[model samples]
Target: MPTPLTPPSAPHWPAPVARTAVDATVALPGSKSMTNRALVLGALASAPVRVVRPLRSRDTDLMADALRALGTGVAEDGSDWLVTPGPLTGPARVDVGLAGTVMRFLPTVAALAAGEVAVDGDPRARERPMGPIITALRELGAEVDDGGRGALPFTVRGRGLVDGGPVTIDASGSSQLVSGLLLAAPRFAKGVEVRHEGPPVPSTPHLAMTVRMLREAGAGVETGENVWRVAPGPLLGGERIIEPDLSNAAQFLGAALVTGGRVTVPGWPDDTVQPGDALRGLLAAMGADVSLGPDGLTVRGSGTFPGVFQGLEADLHEVGELTPVLAALAALAATPSRLTGIAHLRGHETDRLAALVTEINALGGDVRELPDGLEIRPRPLHGGVFHTYDDHRMVMAAAVLGLAVPGVEVENPETVGKTLPDFTGLWTDLVRTA
Candidate 1:
């Protein structure tokens, strides 16, 4: 039985005060979304897929469930997973929670089924983009309902003899559209070659994650990080462990920089491929005592930072996901700073650029919205009701800001459950005291 997930309304926050420096070691969770996508891809591969550290998050869990529905044998061995692929006998039913990954990826997962597979997700997930992939699937002869303007509540019929074709996907909304079709292509009678031409493809790193997982699964894929080609090939089971999330590391890094806290995030991959590493350079510019250790990095925030310039200027194409937190930091800075290369922020959990402009300005900040990012001048943020717009990142962006400013309250703070259900507890180790 699947329970419907209605994001509790936008949350409100409490006022925060400048806290004394705290030091702590945080055990960040594996990226649930990444792990699940990799798991599904691995199930369709040709090697003994061994996932190193997979996510137990809600979205990734949905991916696992979907895999089970397709008859893949997946089990956990200590901290790793051994996935054994089986032929998909679907026409199955899938329920994806508010996880956007499941909603997006399941359509392709549907393509691997023997008959029609009905995939449903949380209302929010349902509302997200599926049209591009749905349309692509139809173009590839997978018999799917377009849902009128690129909507969901559709079906994928994988009867037989369906061959991949040349199709242009409107990836302007999500790069997952491209990844889903790419991964599903190899299973088609013929392979799929994708052409991307919208919004320049957001979070290309995430797409890279998908491609890497596909490669590990014995998929013959060719793409220059964006455009992709997947051909029919042998897929088998293997073992794998996911890398620690670089996105979560950003907040801890910001915490260390904002409050001079000493935080250690172990379990980091040495050959990490996440694009969120732009934080290191950003923190250094903001005047933090930062260094990468053999295990992880250490950041010590000294208030005497942000020497001259009072701000920073950099195109964070690589670390676009961290824009919200970085925007918060810039607003809390001594002077104005501009962030660019984030036009795609508009399409995230919420219209991030608009949300940032509205919320920060509402709190008496002299912040302006950019086509790509935010231009924030030093402004005192007072305690006011800030909404999360049912997006986890917004909640965290506000929470991070709350730590730096007095009277910054975040309502409906529980939306972090998408990935971090225990954030409030996690931060209690260093927040709200002194």
Candidate 2:
């Protein structure tokens, strides 16, 4: 009966509306997983590491605690963290908050420890998946016990993993699986050889970013298209400057594109591998002017807004998490949009496709649900009360619909705290500029 919320203060924008002429530039938050992964890498390496612009979020904080539990010298120096790698031993407890990354990644981080670590998190975190990590860890000689059948509140008894050479992980379900195991390989007894086979991998680019960052930290990693191999070695301490999240920028881009305005997001990584950058192309296809710059990226709106002139069959398997927002766009597009390759959305914080259809349809959009994705036809949505289905993306996506169309009230905006805690403030700032 408990549901996450946006907030009462944020305006309830209605559908079948449009953004008034507006223009503004905004800054983005740092990547939560990337910072935590970098910190973990720093802890597993033999040198001191610094993370520039690290995010102060629940997820990252949990990772820091987990890293510290592993005997890593973790200290904060302003926005930077000074981490010294040492021989890490597991602790009696590891709590990962509500982070999917921490739950998945810490299981492997525990494999490198020498004692029994009972890992758990908040109530919602208990509902998330942990099977892939448990299966992989067991195969690699880790004694892991889940809630009962490899679930949470489980214990991973580590005797220091022997190099489990050439492991194959079906990470298509969650790219975090790939990032989790790959980063933990260097600490394995025999190092790790990971072969990833799944439907089409979700968030391949973010997984690739994990691989790339590991190598930068001094781990030997070879990612030959599909397969990834990591050699056992310490990640050397170094400084990694994490850029503002491009993923978060995609939402604002949606905001500007929906409204008749130019929204510039500063400090985005131009050459970054984050797949959220794919939003640039997705929005452009719908008739938005998006540009990348040295300091950031900008989205100039199209008042005409051809509205997803491209065909509706979008392969969102790589960046499927964006389906909720994209679904809203599809609802307002010239033709129906069918998003495929994301059955995994059902397993997220909420059943996203269902949430998309239920909330959007309630708002008067012609949205329908499919087994794996959705088929949405262009329709004028009448803003009313939009339920966010306890999902942060759902809350924000409904908010996006508000920018162009007025009268849509997003229920429980606080759910945005899962990632962008600054949502209300950011919207206020943008509204002020407009």
Instruction: For residues 1-434, write the lDDT of model 2, one tens digit per residue.
Output: 22534455555433234436557888888887678888888877777888888876667778888888878777889877787877778666889876788988888878778888889887766667667778888887778877566557789888866557767767766888878888888878678877777676787888878988988888888878678888887667779888777777666777665665788888777678887888888888777788888757888776544223332578888888778777776676666688988888776776677778778888788777777788888777676888775576776787677765678877777667767787767876775665
In model 2, where do residues sit more than 4 Å from their true spots?
1-19, 304-312
Candidate 1 — worst ten consecutive residues by lDDT sum? Answer: 1-10
Q: Please, what are the lDDT tens digits per residue for candidate 1 over residues 1-434?
A: 11213344544457354457657677787876568777767767655577777766666767888888877777877877777777777768788766667777777767767877777765556567777788788888778865575665666776744678687887867777887887767777778888987667776777888788777667788886447888887765655567777787777667766675566777666566577656678877887777777868676676432221236777876567788788877777666788888887665566778888888888888878777778888876776767666667777778777776667777677777777777777776656432
Predicted candidate 1, C-alpha RMSD: 3.9
The local lDDT score (0 to 100) that residue 117 gets in candidate 2 is 85
**Each model's TM-score, in the order given?**
0.88, 0.90
Stretches of candidate 1 exceeding 4 Å from the true structure: 1-18, 46-50, 73-82, 303-310, 432-434
